[model samples]
Target: MMQLEQFYCRNYRIGPSESDFRSMYRPSAMLEHMQLAADGDLNAMGISTSEMLEQGLGWMLLATDLSILHPARLDEEVSLFTWSKGSKGVLWLRDFILTNHEGDRIAEARTSWALIDLQKRKPLRPSAMPVEVKAYPEHSLGDIPEKIILPEGRQTRETDRFTARYSSTDSNGHMNNARYADLCCDNLTPVELAAGIRRLQISYYREVHMFEQVIIERTDAADGIIWFRGMAADERGTVFEAKLQLNGAA
Candidate 1:
């Protein structure tokens, strides 16, 4: 069991006049929390890698629901607690709780992941989980969420790619879980993102991490809905797909 310790960190940076309480604790901040959790998970599994290799496997692709409980304020100290929630076959389940210094719960997260053969970039059997770790226990995060699907015949509208930055990976040495959100959003127009979102969903077909290049493919948009898919070059064929809902411009 990986214990709750100082997993990872970043000091708060907002002045009283500069930011509001709610905006300060947006989903983006939660990304820091997820990065810490991914670190703990990697440690627990004993598959920890060096910074160089870790970046290639893109750490925990958070295939579950995340709920925010309380708002985190500027200058508040945030910490994370995580543990294995159990797994079904090759799907590994993990849970995380984010809290502030006063012990106030700020947010909760759960994730599902499939181990992949880093070289082949293909899904590996859950039975492949190291013998050192036990199978994920039983629990419900409501109905198991469905994976996001790429729209049929969607072609590349834009192709933006990134090499995992050293900062992108978590303590476990792989690309941090939250970076996926950053990457997904990178595919959108700034105007669309600023308008706000009602819901956002993404699915991980493969783990992406350091040094790998990823290509973003966008679906045709109409109304206020848009879809996208990202692919990385690898022997195994890993893909990341996402669907986004937008708020109309004022």
Candidate 2:
């Protein structure tokens, strides 16, 4: 059997469907692409999430840090590379680098994942995988997203509310991780949206099932970073939290 390459690359062109109202590629769509690339690479390496599910295991996103350096053009195909960066304790690491035709960087990301026993809802070590995934730590995309703690006493207001409808839920019977990027952007006020997304940092806390109403709460720091915390009307805990850095918010 031919051994698969540790690094994987895929090319994608932005189109009307991938771009938002701003005519720029949507972050949510970009994340979904990343997911597809990751899964494809994993399948080549001898394991796929679908295969894991049969064993009562699944992958869950813990945190992700995506930074956009330059937005890709709608007419141009961009090259994206992804590789596993090994694991840390129970958390598996993955990184991505996206570049345009000229080899100029478009975006990069560092993501953390955890394997879980689907039936028991318990985290498992990467060693439990039926096929071990190789790591290419040399391709790390920088630091993984850190846990975000919303400031105490900072004012946070409800920005938007919506039901986790059928269209948003995946086979897991809950919202997919990538969809939250659009949700976060949709809740942004015009001022915040106009600032433009330069970096997106997210920490997934829990799942939002179909029919559950999610109330998006937002706050901004003096430095221009907009923070969001999604809470479900029926759940006591936060569904997710995210930090958005605008083009010049640094």
Candidate 3:
């Protein structure tokens, strides 16, 4: 682990299994690495999951905005840096930067989280936490839109409903955040997938539990961005929404 002035950094060598058909790091794998970095940072701050649970609290992700400039290839070593960007009421913000071995940035992400009461599942104020908030250097992605808007006049199509499997569920008893990327991407057309995703933004609205069937809907905007929405098949409403900006095919 490498420590910057106020950021926690970790090196990850992209594994063969982590690559997609394009031989580049998959979105889900990148998200998993980001989660690890977040865990490491929280642990360094003496607020690990167990510690939070002991205080009757837990962290819940609200949204994440990731921009990929270049994808990491198999066996490539990437450095990931993360830091807390303070909090706004009940919402805590964190940001990450991923760089290649040459030190050129490949991806950047910003995430929002809420501290929740474990039993009640209600958000708690960040000030109530025992840890000291630190002043950290900022790495802004230049106003990442919190909401992804679908272009007017675009047609929406729905995919076959599928259930949340055991393999997709996390300890929280819901589909893992990273798994949502896979689910969303699975709904993309082969052409769109082949074009390669250059950016992704996901907002988690509700938790989808194991065995709950989900319906994925997508709309392709005129600007080449694909917007996706995952709704509960049982009519419980929208569970998650995502947007993918694709690079033109070679």
The weakest ten consecutive residues by lDDT in model 3 span 136-145
Give per-residue CA lDDT, model 3, range 142-239, as digits (tens). 45339655556767788758689899887666788898889877778888777788888999888888899999888864477788888898889888
Error of 3 at 215 (Å): 0.5
lDDT of predicted model 2: 0.83
**Best prediction by lDDT:** 2
Question: Which ten residues in a row are the worst by lDDT in model 2?
Answer: 1-10
For 1-250, candidate 1 gives per-residue lDDT tens digits of 4334533333334344322333554454465556555655566566654532454443345474566555566656666666565566666676666777766666666677766666655556755545355333443344445687865666657557677768776554556556666676666676665655544566766555678777777775567677777777564565677766665512
Rank all candidate structures by their lDDT, best first, as comma-separated numbers. 2, 3, 1
Off by over 4 Å in 1: 1-29, 38-64, 67-73, 77-83, 97-108, 115-139, 153-156, 169-175, 197-199, 207-210, 220-225, 233-238, 246-250
Question: TM-score order of candidates, best first?
Answer: 2, 3, 1
* Preferred candidate (TM-score higher): 1 or 2: 2
Query: How many residue pairs of model 2 clash at the backbone?
Result: 0
Clashing pairs in 3: none
